[model samples]
Target: MNNDHDSSLPEGLDLRALSAFVDGELPPVERAAIEAQLAQQPQAAARVAAWRAQKTALQVLCGASLRNERQAHNESSGGVGQRDVDEPAFIVVRRPTPWWQRVGLAACWLAAGAGLALALGPLAPRLTGGAWNGLGGQPPSFAERADIAYAVYTPERRHPVEVAASEEEHLINWLSKRLNRPLSVPSLQEYGYSLVGGRLLPGEAGPAAQFMYENTSGARLTLYITGISRDETAFRLFRDGNRRTFYWINDRMGYALSGPIAEGKLRAIAIEVCSALGGKPESWQ
Candidate 1:
């Protein structure tokens, strides 16, 4: 009865279920079900790869920051042999907490302060730029990042991506492992472009993914992705040097396409990718 490895998984494993599989929280039956989905749904596998990359990136960023701070302290204090009165009690500052957070207090007090804090949070942070300025943490610059990545990978001849599209199953499984997002590499054959290949890219968010397709004349386009990030708040067209970028983001993930194609043709390409992606343009804005 099983047609593919993915067919042996639960049923059609949606993004959420795939995420659970990556996180090691899925039970065996459920895990098997997701494996089933992966066998048939390439896009779902790609999403899983993007999500896995995000998890690794998050840990790396956090771990590096911690390690750097400790190293700095050791260097300044002569390997912790000396201490100064002016030195703060803690060697390194932890991630900031916004002013409205009253977690240390009683649960009763937390309820009352939560609403007022969130309401007034932005204004106070902007005004002071102290706790709020560096507080609540900062997100990586997704827009500029997306652009840079688009510019870097679209021009390769020999090694543009890690897993080439010819091995569609391998590409899906590898990316799914790397991204932690269940991905489906939307078929672009109807757009006159067949799959050329896909690559894993490093990004501020994590290992970003790019899938390349080529047309008859060797013209190529790419689909860039990561687990959902806030920068995908709007649908916009971006131009970098001579290349064109058409990008959009949805609830579960984000996508950007870059290439040296005509705008009219590129728009059609983007529309097809978006439709295959199963995203709503309205939510992006």
Candidate 2:
């Protein structure tokens, strides 16, 4: 696989190679080659950055569990004792587990305890309570996820979405079935943003959909949709770094419009989207 020169290029680097590079599993020579290619490919570099960010997030979420496990292992086996160098003591150096391996274990632990913390909504305050108050009082998790999805996909020069706008009907139908809800693709052309495409995603409850749109200036926006148990919310704005999302729940469904544009412009676009989808646009005021 390392001998394939074509695979080293941005266009040819497959997901497996990219995963290996993110995991730091590549040899120095192959790693250097991929790095050179990534430097020339902003989209590919963005993907790598996203993966790294995901790993970091997982580590933080599962840090306490990991520490407990490490402590347990240390107790099960006799703890290592310090030795003085002047005594000429023989010290056994045990290599630590790789971060990826530890993170994998933490992921399993998290999966086993998933039900404790579900999607953020009205019930979220009761479930997570003061734990998430620092994030501006139970900020919707789906909207934050939408912001992340937009950041991850909008930088692509090619293959930004799983399906293209040319296959709009098929894309909508497929996503609708997967999400178990009739979905509509809002026409953003009037706002100078045309539909680019969309893809299915894993949501806090079940499947979610993300429809992407791009304007003439190459600026992109995405509308993320998912099912919710209840319908009670006013338009709310969530800011994550440079990205902002205007989101709300209506008719037992949640929608988040995410972009890097100015707050006023994105809110206008989001209000239009809400109105098109039979939502109460007046609530946005």
Candidate 3:
């Protein structure tokens, strides 16, 4: 093998070697080499851990199917007992390779790739410096967290906010102090939404704020705010089912406006809110 390190895997190790090591099929010398590499490389160790986790998950998911297949095979081969004397009952008997596995290492690589995708999710992109938008298996973006918060709190008939809109000043001052930034509530009255209240939320970096608003028809929107290290300002949209969020970064502050509303309407409101909060107009998208 070339053994040159790549973005995804460690030097001197590939999926085949890793899989065989996981299966306890590697010889003593090769296994020792892999063990040494894993001991020295945290990334490689993480990959091995993920593959092991994936194998366990697959065994659980496919247990019944595998049992049925095994039963059929045993019936055709003089009805072998359910368990071997030395080997566990769960172990599949050795036989000719299946069609999928017959394609050689390519199929193994593909299967491992799928397992890796499942194990890493959104974090895989950050790990490999690639682009992936899959959800879960990692902490979500600020906007996605906003979307989850919206879904959680919006349906409540009462107690949707920690502080009611009647005490808007106290809510703003409290959140501002907690967030270490002067926070202000944007007036959405022109868009037929009135402030319902605001609440404190747990953010990835620190405390965050969520300001809720409601229209006469009971439609609700939330504005999520937090301090960010990124100084660049750019507008981006995130959607989950019927909910949508328009998030932007400006002046080291992150803002995400989320609701079950049309995209254009939400974008317009996000722009207006950004402008009100001192974000430059040219940064709106």
The digit string of per-residue lDDT tens for model 1 on 1-285 reads 533435433455544567679988989998887778787877777778888898777656546445557768888988963444443334344888765565555566777787767777668766666545221323234434666765676577787777777798898888878988777888888878888878787755688777888889877777888765553345667666777777766774667777778887887777777877777654533
Per-model TM values vs. the true structure: 0.47, 0.54, 0.54
Tens-digit lDDT string for candidate 3 (205-238): 9999999999999999999998876666657778
The count of backbone overlaps in candidate 3 is 0
Best-to-worst order by lDDT is 3, 2, 1
Clashing pairs in 2: none
User: Which lDDT values do the candidates have, in the order given?
Assistant: 0.70, 0.83, 0.84
Backbone clashes (count) for model 2: 0
Looking at candidate 1, the ten consecutive residues that score lowest on lDDT are 133-142
lDDT of 1 at 56: 72
TM-score of model number 2: 0.54
